[model samples]
Target: MRKPQVHWDDVEIGGELAGFDIEIKPRRVFLQISGSQDWYPVHHDPAFARKGGHEDIFMNTGFTQAALVRMITDWMGDGGFLRKLYFEMRRQQRPGDTMACRGKVTDRYRKDGEGWVEVDVWAENEREGVTSPGRAWVILPMRESS
Candidate 1:
């Protein structure tokens, strides 16, 4: 029983989720690398990334996914559960890029005595339009919903 910032009854198909912005500094990238345990040199080694023809050391796939999850979960609050999430990295997220995490409600429905919401999510960088694009399904608590 988690307390909800948003109730099932209050959601709309086209509603927007709260967005988060972060500057992709080396420290942040290091933290992401550490937290995810993804030690790919490309994530932390600029030389390796440059050797691979990338501009600079960049955020990894797992970090990108986590950003999307953070955006959805922050919007849904502790009352909700992230049932499913899917995303793709279209471009590299490098240091000095500002990552803008955004989401929009695509659908809302109830099934099996539970309330669910479908949201389209993405991370847009100032340098590149969208580095990651995805979707997520969340289970939110009902408020006088039937």
Candidate 2:
């Protein structure tokens, strides 16, 4: 199916949007797990992760959440700006797994003569289920008349 190209006027109170899939690799995981210099074995050591009850080293929650935002921005395009974004982690995302990021428009309105859209968003991992789910608000440029 063709992807959605949502104009400011095309958004509604309950419009839904499909998410795209992304695969998590070790290198990506390294980029995501950034906080401290602590060499926590679980984060980078597969052996330690296994001992900690995880199958292997996993990506950081913050990184996965950020991916959700990137997904939304890519979907909305450069003409859209993110106003608000929030998410909660539901599961762990191990390497080699693919996950989907999705969103649905729950509200839309005009403020200060600009168009805004609110969306319910989520990220689902094949190995760990819905890794994150949350809401976002974006302001898109007004569409021009044909």
Candidate 3:
């Protein structure tokens, strides 16, 4: 589905992007593991996770990265193209935890005639202050050029 377009001229540096909250469930964790072909038992088996010293089954880094990317693109809409995404996994996200994904536009500029915005993004849980911290570069289409 095409999302509402966010024009380059309308963006603001230091502006907060739309954020989302999600409750991580065991089913969702399993789905992510199956979809991503991540067959590691730590992602889907709580017993295995406990053996590894974690409280329970936790999300994989690859899945977490994909979710962060979704958070950015979903807010930027269809007109925004993700140029780069980098993140560090600070903490493990477990089932029954609510994760808040948020972002802020840090910088905006024109590069090679294309408008770009650099965003600082993160996912925080009630227990873990920050689970994943990352940055992304997105290209937003200009209204005049579109």
The global C-alpha lDDT for each of the candidates, from Candidate 1 onward, is: 0.89, 0.76, 0.87
List TM-scores for all candidates, in order.
0.91, 0.74, 0.90
For model 2, how does the per-residue alpha-carbon lDDT over 57-126 read when each residue is reduced to its tens digit?
A: 8666656666777778876876789988888876777789886888888888889888888899988876
Model 1 per-residue lDDT at 7: 84
TM-score of 3: 0.90
- lDDT over C-alpha atoms for residue 29 of model 3: 82
Candidate 1's residue-wise lDDT over 9-120, tens digit each?
Answer: 8899999988999899878987997889999999998899899999898898888888888888788898899999989988978889999999999999988889999999
Q: Which digits, one per residue and each the tens of the lDDT, describe model 3 over residues 19-130?
A: 8887898678877877688988988988998999988888888788878987888878887899999999889788888888899999998999999999999998999889
Clashing residue pairs, backbone N/CA/C < 3 A, model 3: none
List the candidate 1 regions with Cα displacement exceeding 4 Å: 1-4
The number of residue pairs in model 3 that clash at the backbone is 0
Instruction: Put the candidates in lDDT order, highest first.
Output: 1, 3, 2
What is candidate 1's local distance difference test score? 0.89
Poorest 10 consecutive residues by lDDT, candidate 3:
26-35
